[model samples]
Target: MHSKIFRGIQQEDVQVAADALIAEGLRPTIERVRQKIGRGSPNTVSPMLDNWFAGLSKRLGVANASDEQRLQPPEPVQAAAAMLWQAAMQLAKHAAQEEFLQENQKLDMRRAELQNHEAELISRQEAFNARQIALDETLQLARDQLTAMTSRLEEAGILQARRDREIEELRQQLKSREDERDAELQRRNDDATRHADERLRLEARATANEHRWLTELDRERLEVKRVVSAHIELESRAQATQTQLKTAQAALLDRLNQAERSLKDEHHAHELAKMHILELQSSLDVCRLAYAEIIKSQASQEPKNSRRKPLKQLMRGVTVRRKL
Candidate 1:
């Protein structure tokens, strides 16, 4: 991995080269050696660098105290070391500046990505709000329509109930009228039957009176014949029987006239009774017909029940008037 990052040589190979160089008494900084030969195995290269630095410091008679110590040398060695240090410092400065620039570029890319994400978030939020508004409007419309339908359904139920009540009331009224008609008819039937029975009794009584009058007439005729035969015997015997015969004839005529008068009176009473019976029968028939007519009229009127068509038309006219 280190070889790929630095290129051309493996980390182990770099470590071996750095170690060999250090063993020949070369002193190098880890960063400088990394630039030259790349980062090597720490176990091999790190100790070599530390040892070389210690040996070089001793050879140059550097102080043991920790400070920003410089290498002091013979005049010729001092000039060479100063030049090398100057070059190494310049290279390290250039590498640090390059790393700083790369870091700044990375920060700029991250800022651009964050700005784009914020803009996308704002767009998504606006779209979500618009969709929410649309959904609320749609729900409100649905609720309004549902409320209107429910009101219409309730009104329809009320109207149906009213219609049912009206129909039931009409049926009850018709039943009451029918019961009244039936009662009237029964009364008329009873009266008619009574009249017929009375007429029959009167006719039978008239027939019995006629039979008794015929029997009386036959007995009176036989008595008159007997009295005439006795009167003839008395006349032949003596002239003095003439007055008794005249008296007997007058009594027989009187009795016959009385029976005729009684029969005529009975016949007149029977005629009067028959006339009364006929009058009663006529009255009963007229009453029955009137009752039947009443029933028919009531039945016909029951269906109208105040005439809904006219009422509806009137209501419509009123509404139109109000609108106008």
Candidate 2:
């Protein structure tokens, strides 16, 4: 029942419809055919195919010169020629669709590869930023340590100065005591020798105490000097460390700047590539439109009967050559 209904349209008419669709840049696959005729399923396409064959068979049967000529060319020849033209056009559309599909696949693959490259660049940039942050923290820590060492060194110097002042005052007090003791001895010359001996002994004891205090002060000063020297050495080391840190930071900054520049270049390249892809897509669309227009123009220009004879002859020759 379905075949009978679809057979009513005839193959030649189906071929013409297919040619028209192809000329309009529409592909004529089974699904497309079903959609074009507002039907559903592969069953619909099968009937359409049967109808197409029936129409082509009738046109081929009537191609031999016989009966009355309705148009400039005989009806049968024109119909057969139109059917062949439609078939040829459909074949062309199929080839174009296949080529277009392959091109789209290639474009999709290239886009994926570019996206992956962009992702890797982003990851590298993130890692560089992390390293820069770490370097900055390290530099800050080194600076803080250097500053603390400087403050400690200053405190040590102040303490050493105070110790020197105390030592000087003690020396002056000892000198005055010795002068007083000598004056007392000169004044006591008419007195007893025992008192003079006792006075000398006391003065010697005072001198010994002064000498001991002076030695102790010298030792304290030496100890302070050692500490100050050690502190100065530490300060010098801190300064060296600070200098090294600064140099390292500078180098890191340079590297970061270089990376930033590289990233900028990459971004620019990606943008350019994106633009190029867009232009290519636009060109492809234009080419497709031009192709469709060309097909339509050719279809309009060529006579229905004249277009198919060469191709039919070629096909017949191929068959004949195969048989030979």
Q: What is the TM-score of each candidate against the true structure?
A: 0.35, 0.43
The local lDDT score (0 to 100) that residue 189 gets in candidate 1 is 60
Point out the worst 10-residue segment of candidate 1 by lDDT: 298-307
Encode model 2's per-residue lDDT on 1-324: one tens digit a residue: 455544343444456666667778964554455555665544334446545644553566765333333335767877886677666545544554555566567666756766675676566667656765665666566566656655665666676567656656665665676566566655555443546667665777757866876686677657656755665676666567656656765665566566557656665765675676567567656656755664454334222233435886645543442332
Query: Residue 310 in candidate 2 has what lDDT?
Result: 88
Query: Model 2, stretches more than 4 Å misplaced?
Result: 1-69, 72-87, 181-324
Candidate 1 error regions (>4 Å): 1-79, 194-324
Task: List, residue by residue over 31-137, the lDDT tens digit for candidate 1.
Answer: 44554565554334434544454455556776564453443346776566445434433443344345445545655565565556556655655665565565556
Task: Give candidate 2's error at residue 4 in angstroms.
Answer: 25
Kindly report the root-mean-square deviation of model 2 from the true structure over all alpha carbons: 10.3
Highest lDDT: give the candidate number: 2
